[model samples]
Target: MTTPNNGDTVTIDYTLKRGDGEVVGSTQEVGPQQVQLGAGQTFPQIEQALTGMEVGENKVIAIDCANAFGPRNDQLVIDIPRANLPPEPAPQPGMALQAQQPDGTPMTLYVVEVGEEQIKADGNHPLAGEDITFDLTLRDIKQAA
Candidate 1:
């Protein structure tokens, strides 16, 4: 069996879990993912691990907080005046809202609290500060043509 190398297109089935074992992401629903190794399509660590493997090989990878999503920033937790939010739909906790950064870049903010005067939203990724795990299975690999 040929092993995967840089620039090789690889098909893999993967499930991502948080440190608490919470299932965060998986390819089961959408099917396997195709990524070209060393192309930055996936995490560098994961790509390194996929460097050598045969088809149908299964491996579990543990990524630290720094490498996974990086540490959470407390400053990202901000409270916005309720008056600034839309009055029709109303904002609630656990809602994902689209917002823009000072640089005009689009971002997703998660609602953490809904108060009478303000709504607390977090700009940090939900998985930030958590060490994550990846369960990966190599399905196929094609050498770069």
Candidate 2:
């Protein structure tokens, strides 16, 4: 049995859940995912957990909120004048908008409040400030060349 190591390509099936036990993401919906160990394609915590795991092994990894998505920042929630938003499609609560930061990096902002004069947007990840868990099954390993 081959064990996964850094640089190896591994196939894994995983179900992700929040601290509240809410099922947030799963490979069942998208199929097994291939991750390149140490390539930074996935979370570092996951890569660490996969190290030395043989095919067909199962493991559950827990990540705290700070290490998962980082803590939420109050400054990330900002209110913009309604006039600044595009008139088409009209901004609505729960809508996600693509915005460019001052540094030219793209950011995803979620609409939290739609007011008559101001629209509230939160730049934090939806899962920010929440602990997450990953139930993983190592399905296959392709040894690095």
Candidate 3:
């Protein structure tokens, strides 16, 4: 009956959903999520919710995009010349393409439209600007050193 406090390690199985009740993510499919309480590995809202839970506890969390991945930025979506794309992949609309930032971090861009000479790329997080709910269960809790 060890309850989670700050600095404890907690293992959880979670499912993420949209406000419309659509499933967004799940540990039941990808495996349970493991994190250290108060270690900043999760969203602040989520961490706050786990403050009092113990091993085997389960809870559902609802949060807005600002508390999740943050709001979407219109500027992140840009149009790039089609010629910039590799000739082999043959860019197509709706395709998820990997683009890089100036610092070399990889970004995911969806092909909004394939034009005669340009392709649209959006750098927003897929879950950005969307309100989401997370259903999380604590599978394990360990005390910190």
Residue 5 displacement (Å), model 2? 1.3
Error of 1 at 36 (Å): 1.6
lDDT, residue 102, candidate 2: 97
lDDT of 1 at 73: 96
Best by TM-score: 2
The predictions' CA RMSDs to the true structure, in order, are 1.7, 1.4, 2.1
Off by over 4 Å in 1: none
- What is the lDDT for 47 in model 1? 97
Taking the tens digit of each residue's C-alpha lDDT, what string does model 1 give over 8-99? 99999999999999998999889999999989988888999899788899999999999988999999999999998889688988899899
Ranking by TM-score: 2, 1, 3
Pairs of colliding residues, candidate 1: none
Q: If the candidates were sorted by their lDDT against the true structure, best first, what order would they fall in?
A: 2, 1, 3
Which stretches of model 2 miss by more than 4 angstroms? Answer: none
TM-score of 1: 0.89
The candidate with the higher lDDT, 1 or 3, is 1
How well is each residue in 1-145 modelled by candidate 2, as lDDT tens digits?
6788899999999999999889999998999999999999988999999997888999999999999899999999999998998898999899999999999999999999999999999999999999999999999998899
